[model samples]
Target: MLSGVGACPAVSAAEADTTDNAALNDANTTIIVTGLKPDEGQNKISQSGALGAKTLFDTPYSISVIDAEDITRRQANSIGQIFANDPSVFSSAPSGSTNWWGTQIRGLGVRNYYIDDVPLLLYWGGDFPLEPIESVTALKGLTGFMYGFGAPGGVISYRTKRPTAEAMLTTEIGYRTSSVFYARADAGGPLSQDGRLGYRVNIGGEKGNAYNQAGINRLVGSLALEYAISPDLKWYATATYEDSNLQHEPFQFYWANYVGNSLPRPTYDYEKLNVANSYYKARTLAAATGLDWTFARGWSARLTYGYTNKYHRSNKMFVYMRNQAGDYDGYAYNFAELDQNHFGQAMIQGDVMTGPIRHQIVTGASFQQTDSAFGYNDRDYYWGNDFNGNIYQDQPFRVTRAIRFGTGGWPSKEQQRALFLSDTLHLGEHVQAMVGARHTRYRLADLDGNPLVDSGYRTSAVTPTLALIYKPAPYASLYGSYVEAMEPGSRVGGEYANVGEVLKATLSRQYEIGAKYEHRQFSLTLAGFRIERANTIDRLINGARHLTQDGLTLYKGVEAIGSYRFSDRLKLGAGVLHLGPSIRNVSAGNEDLRGNIPAGAAKWQLTGSAEYYVAAIPGLSLHGNLRHSGKAPTSDSNTLYVPAYTTANLGFQFNTLIGGRKVTFTGNVNNLLNAKYWTQTNIGEGINAAMSVRLSL
Candidate 1:
């Protein structure tokens, strides 16, 4: 059973400011907490973290904070691995035949990724690296009301380490199976005599191999600078670069008729068959600068600008064996493709306070452009009679030589412009309200100078959100919200019949209600939400064309999370999630996709973690985690399924003094039992175990 800490009396509206002042004075003696502090009293309710920082424990939302200590304890090498312990979140290979992992939240896709307070639009196509991050925050549910133009799924914000007043240096090296190697170094301090100016730099690289014989290699680096021009104005800039070379494995699917069957299947030599003959290369660079100013009274303003460029190329080879007279021989089917993109954005935000009402406002405009070019070259080879005979006997064969060339053209470009505004109002001591809206226009252009069918075609949409928060006391709060969102449609394959027709944006609506409770040693939250979408895109039975008019989908679910401290040296965390059935409606002529559970939507999920201090040995601790995911349908048909599975992990940490200097050592064993299970039955792939060690100074 969980017990809640009683709430404190709500401060009167007239005395709220006085109460804040007193709280601020009391905090002066306490240690400053980084990345969790509130901005100011006037910005409290409307601000993202404005609510009492410590009171986050009381919020009724599915939230997880991967703090610095967790980062070290888990030996996390990338952002994708950081949330592996969270039951609701799942990581899988990208569908585009790449090595990158697509992290999903509550069965919905995450579209936007943020660094610090700025948004990074280039999360896809394997652009950014997870190194150089100090911590990551995962917020579930509709946060569009706070961040603007985000997925209903959730948002991940990564906060990078900044130069501290004190100088520091750190480095690490590690190795794993398949000759994998990892190395990283970071250093920073004041660049000038005055602490007002500072600079920090980071560099890292990795090379490794996967269980399937695929190779991975990448290099990552970043630089940041901060300057305080005066007491009221400040500026900061950050830049990052990443390059990766990866070998990809093709997906395999089994026949639906084969279920719970045991047979000694023939194992083909993957290397000999060259079944996974594909390689991808990508490079990305991005930079951002921000200016902040404080005015007289309780007025402040901020402006930020960012730009990114990404390039990718891939080569794939297909192999097939044909039986002629008697022997087996190999034939090759190959293709090569390339893609490039450039993105830029700018935003301005401000806040102000009036007599009894405090208003937090964010108004900004942004533009993004993406250009891609794809042309494939193919080859075909034939084996002689000798090899054909081997094939007849079910013997392995290899492609001696072949030559073939094929050509197809795919050149496309897209442009988008958007503007958004939001305001949060404090009605009184116990109630707060927030309302916001956004407008966006999108355009797609053809490769030739001539206008594409949908060229110059424009669609505009307005999304609004409303929220009410009632905090009767300091330790508990209840909230409910209604939000509207939309996803733009692409003009691919000339699907839109009315090229000149102005189409409205596809729209989605979400309704949510939840409550939060917090105590000195425990916290809990329970939330329920429903989401509906219209004009969802779908394909015909033949899969030759797409129909824009036949798309509709609905998703609803309940999520609950809690954390409790059992003792001064022990703690526990747990969560449970249940998603309702998803439904789709379409014309009868189309594929039979009605009454099917949504792909990737699990019915039940659970996660729990425990931590304990080793009283017998000082400075030693142990941690363990367990995760379970329920069965899920593979596709719209819902005929095929992937059975549920659970995994466990264990680790240990120790703190000691080396030459009178503080140091920490950590080790972890992921997949403690080394279980073999398929996450996606349709995709036919599985993840193996990993062991890692790390030292921090």
Candidate 2:
């Protein structure tokens, strides 16, 4: 292990220059391990390398970044709320107050929760508070090569607010028509005379009722600390805690009820669900510690260790009434889960000039282990009769009639180890080339130490990336690249019948190309991509509930993103996506899923926003946002479709002098049209208008 302090003035100067350029310059740059060194400009770290942002703009990939400014302008209540203006992303279901809606990127299942540079795979339900976030970066496509394993659809990374030397405080409170209340506080600055030691903390809480008669209450807290051991060495630690309790009404699919045409309004009984006390409660705790070492010359090293624990319990009752005789039968379910994870990473980075070839290189190793335990206990109940569609039960049903169904109990664990090498080669003054490759090996095992799947299930992969950037001028650049990524499959258990060990997991691959243009006050990016995956996983129509198989799927699309600074007081940003055709292939018995478009892949999506700051009003500003999503099917059955919908949002904020102190007032109206739209049909939830207020000092 490398420890202690090392001296190198050259390394410090070079690192300082890189960090300064990224922080002070507004231009996009690649984000890589070395590119994120402390002291960089205003969180200007790259998503990939030092110039990663520029490269991302030019590459043939659809991506989006929600900056701090965007969050404030939108007055977003939750992360899912921010997605309302994003077309390429959609949610599958609502977690009520406890869970975030599952996200679908590029028509593929993907999770959108991350802290610092680590992925948060376990879903504890509810949305993460935005108080401690600096920015949200979304990469579209198979990004396993950059962010590590899992879905090929893409990845989302949230950079948390770090401790700063400057002290600042902000507090906000808001309310909506749905009887929701929100409050948050953020304070940070140096905790000691020496700025080397600093601290930051953020707290947020919310309570609300929804149009669907559900209710939500949530709390979040985060803390960060940093200590400078010496000029050449530093250490930092961060911790976050979240708790959410939510009651939600189960969605009733109207399209499914009408078969081909749209059905009438649903008679949702919020009272019955409340009586059943259908709700879910979840808690998550995460902590991380990291150390940075600066060496003499042009070299540095960093190590980070992190752990996360998540616990969730949910109770829901589902009823299907037969006839109008006040008769009904349903199942009440209680699910409990515990997920624990540990992650470790170590990296060495340096710059060198070998003859005429100038090179910047980074090599790192990482390991992640996730262990999870899941259990479910369910009971069956019945009502004497059903009065039309009413859910009133006149008599108490039998309790002992509930049999102890077999329990699905197991401790599943997955481990991944990876080594990667990346280099940026300067080809003369105006041109540069980037090439990198990563090798990863992963293993999975059940609690009993038995093999979870076949030999092929334990696998390794080599992913490669290449890109070229030509900067003819100081303020502009043109770039393009080719990249390939892979995704591993899940291991099957021995209890599954009929499925041979040979068919345990799934594998995925993607190919992409694109271009970007950047100028002083405006930036535009357009990219077209084709993605293909083999050994894809799909559920069989009549097979066991969890049964899945290796198949093939293809998705191709084009996306455009642009942002323009009209003036010092006005700015505009917009994005549009068009997917050509998405198809799925399954076995003969799985014909039900063949030839139909995948769920969540809309043909068209559009989003645009405008913001204006009024100097006349002094610290007053106004913002408007619009979003539209095309028709989308609920499943491969293609029998049901969620119609296209559009929504608008407006917000205003200003600061006032009160009693010799500065006070800020803010307000927002979400869903300005109060449009009744189904974000996800399977979940039977609709979007409604809401308003809120905030005051800060």
Candidate 3:
């Protein structure tokens, strides 16, 4: 019999990083696992929708899984902070700013995210709390065959913490940076004597002055319930809420009407500059329910539904620098934003044999409806203020008006329906092939507050995927895949002439080849990929700037990530990425810009980590991380660039038994050298530190 498919093979237990938090004993333990783990069976599983619960070994995708233990080690609070060491993810904006400043994966903007495989409504980036998540999986490249109607860049999926069979409770207190304090609690266990009902709860809060000397606050709460209806069927439900406030959030710098050839270094202090208004508030609520059933020996079915509601109130100020002298004109914009989504899906998979060949087949259908609303009146407002200030000056923040809740009106609505099917053919003991396609129907509408004047676009597409896998050795797998995706057109920003106009839908394609190897104490993964998509560029038309789809953009890259356990006390991991991005096939008027490097594309990135457990100390470990980012083009024409930089981080953890209870302490310092650097084109950050103490009961 054949087991489930995985991207990579499993490793020995001694090489894996394991903790006894759930089944603790008298023995002291050290846990500092990061990135991909060397675990077996269910612990090594990467949730691949339609492909089943496959491990990393034989799967055809280039994916990375970061567990909760790694997240804690880095003290990541937002999505930007989570992948700080990943070679393939580049932050598009500052980490401490609004959630919209998301990362670019493989030189492409992130357009899709999922919670437990259910798609979310967040079209941009997300800043959801990480305390309640068990793990995060990043699947690189196009995923239209698996997930419909999304960007070609990649997909970010979050796995939530579920109920445990054994009762468990843990609490922790932490502090970060200049003056931030926080506490968190997690509890899970069986709720019924029969062990058929279980529950999990998580809650946390943080508040204090951030590195910028601005007030920052966050609160999160979540609950999960599970019930076993039968030996083969299980039902689960979850609800989560998060609220955050950042006083003086840094607004992203947009180059609309600029005269300078290059961006200048900040003349003011990185942390002390107050560019935006008083504050920005964001609130998120999500709920999901699903069922899993195994009706037969080799077949199973899953049904799921999810809903998400996100709200944001921003009173941000935008300043455009006009010259090299740091002089600028500033404007204030106030708006309330809302995003909502309702998603549902049904999937089934099973195995069968025809003659000498084995086939694992999967089929699924999904539907999602999303609504986005924005308001500028009835409490919200925007202005081309007469205020003018220099970047080196300490200008007073523009006062904000009061906000009347529930006064916003829906402006945009989108609906997507998809049907997909895939088959994995086990040709022999050493070879497998996969083929799949998804048919999607997408509709978009613009409601101008008049029921009679609804305008929109309707389109349909069929995206497909093909892959081949070869296993020459039990511990090694080589594969190649091709995928295509359809993305919805984007609306023009307020700075453009056709501000509210939506362009036609675009298509993207990807070609990838990868290899994975795992043995006793060593593991390695290497991949090469290329993606092509229609470029969206701004052009001067009729004396006005308009954003339109034109020409083509190409992104090609090679990435390698691996880990090795040199000894029982020593381990090392590293990753490297190289990218070649360019533009092509532009109009004659823009011929000079052809073959130029795309903006925000870094040429090279290297990241490495080392961890060691002290033999003399019972349960003490030390870990360090280093990253180097190469120079990146700041403009599409490649006329400007941001210098390369390197950063280092160091941390330590210790565990001990106090009063017959397990207690642990952790501390870390990011940017240990206190080097100031720009995270993006114009976004920069100051050094920070974090420490926490946790107790298990």
The prediction achieving the highest TM-score against the true structure is 3
- RMSD value for candidate 3: 3.6
Candidate 1 vs candidate 2, TM-score winner: 2
Q: Model 3 over residues 174-193: C-alpha lDDT tens digits? A: 99877889999989889999
- lDDT per residue for candidate 2 within 1-697, as digits (tens), equals 0000000011111112100211212111211122112322112234542123333323334456665545765666554565655666665553343333356676766653566665565554525557777767667777655656666777766667778667766666776556777788777778888788998898988787765567767899999999999999999998888887776545222222223434233333444433234566778777889998887687888888888777776554434333333233444445566777888888777889988888877778888887776552233112221222334432232223333322245446778888888787877777778887777787765543345453334777777767776767533345566666656554443223322233443456665555555444555566677777653333534554334654466777877766666666676778787886555667776666676776556878888877676656555667787888788775556666667877677887654445433455667776676665554433333444444343333
* Whole-structure CA lDDT of model 2: 0.58
lDDT of 2 at 231: 93
> Sorted by lDDT, highest first, which candidate order results?
3, 2, 1
Worst 10 residues of 2 by lDDT: 1-10
Q: Rate the local accuracy (lDDT) of all candidates.
A: 0.54, 0.58, 0.74
lDDT for residue 607 in candidate 2, whole number 0-100: 82
TM-scores, all candidates, are: 0.78, 0.81, 0.93
lDDT of 3 at 608: 83
Stretches of candidate 3 exceeding 4 Å from the true structure: 1-24, 27-43, 123-125, 256-262, 267-272, 275-277, 376-386, 400-410, 449-456
Could you give candidate 1's per-residue lDDT for residues 1-697 as a string of tens digits? 1111111211111112110111222211212111112321111222232121223433334555564446656665544456655656665542223523256677765665666555555433422475666557666655644454445667776666666565666565655444567787777778889889987788888787654445668899988888899988889888878887766443222222223322112222223322344456667666778777775455555666666555554443322222112122332233323333344444445556788887756566666665654342223221123222221133233333443322234455666667777676777777768776766666666543244354554556677777777888665678887877665553332222332222345667888888776645566667788877653444444544343555566778887766766665676878887888566676665457776676667888887878776666655678888878787775555755666767777877655445433344566666666544445421322233344433233
Better of 2 and 3 by TM-score: 3
RMSD in Å for all candidates: 8.6, 8.4, 3.6
If ranked by TM-score, best first, what sequence of candidates would result? 3, 2, 1
